[model samples]
Target: MYGFEIEGGFTFYKFRDFDGSLSLSDDHLKWFWEKMGKAGQISVVFYDGSVESFEDFKKLAKLKDQHFFLGFKDGRPAGMFWLNGFTQRSCFVHLTIIPDFHGKAALQMGRGVLRHLLSVTDVSGSYILDCVKGLIPVMNSLACRMAQRSGFEKAGVIQKAVYLAAEDKSVDAAIFCAVRNNEVKVSE
Candidate 1:
């Protein structure tokens, strides 16, 4: 409700407070695809090992139950995320702090943005969500650690859950969760 929604954005979910938003015009979409296809970025997020074309990236971006947002700080892009499998109360999240901001303020931003997300309310004046989940590749220890620092708890692991394109194989995924009144503990 605080952020200005533009022509190419998810108006309901935009947040200016934490400086994260989704504005998906064609040109901006192209920028997202190009940035996400970077060697470091692609390895963690894409199962195809690459986004071969803008079309492919577009399809993924517009996939059912998936919403993407770019994080910003001082008007500069800082990170990005995919919110997947969104239901009335739960969703799966994949987040990445840009390489430049890595190890700098990952924990602070992650916790703040996530807590704010949990506090978002729908037009009906009800809390929109109660939980957010992270399904991370087991090999990505850094991500796992960051999730913990962001107040997520290790829930479990799913076998052969994530297919890494670069690895050309399926890898186990570690599940992490932050519940609104529990782990996340959002307050007024």
Candidate 2:
């Protein structure tokens, strides 16, 4: 039932179930795969930054250092977030938001998700996170702007940091960094 209620009086994201558990399941993964499959582009990261086919997604999803989680809106898959490169205080974040989600609500949802993920504590009550990073493809200007609005600030751009399967070329990635702080507002 955890969701973001925007100005229009509608919820833009719903990641939790009635029992307060995040609705993470094979169904979510399947939904993500179908979306990526339809787009004809692979969204999973490669260890060597080489482009790989969809066949590798399931196998690579088990990579020890990385994990994926799904977010929802109105009981439908809204986005998938890949959290990787975890260290004591930081991790890399990658995202694939549903193309249909548009406008201010999408931006608000991004902000809320980032803030919630970074600020949340586990049952043990420990704070093992200090920062989260985004290496967004430079061509995706909307994502870059969304990151800025979501508490992530520009770090720098890395050349050929991401492989664009659709374009069949490597693209520059815009580095965005968000440190753990109380200033990340969950809503406007």
- lDDT for each residue of candidate 1 in 3-120, tens digit (9 for 90 to 100): 4222212122222223333344556556555666663576566654656567877777665556766666644456666677877799888777766566636666677667766777
Worst 10 residues of 2 by lDDT: 6-15
For each candidate, the alpha-carbon lDDT, in order, equals: 0.67, 0.64
lDDT of 1: 0.67
Position 117, candidate 2: lDDT? 63
**CA error at residue 139 for candidate 1, angstroms:** 0.2
- Model 2 clash count equals 0
Off by over 4 Å in 1: 1-22, 48-50, 183-188
Cα lDDT tens digits for candidate 2, 25-143: 44556676777666643544332334254446644554555565565666666666667798887898876666656567567557766775677575798765778888888877877
Task: Assess candidate 2 and give its TM-score to the true structure.
Answer: 0.72
CA-RMSD of model 1 = 6.0
Task: Tell me the lDDT of candidate 2.
Answer: 0.64
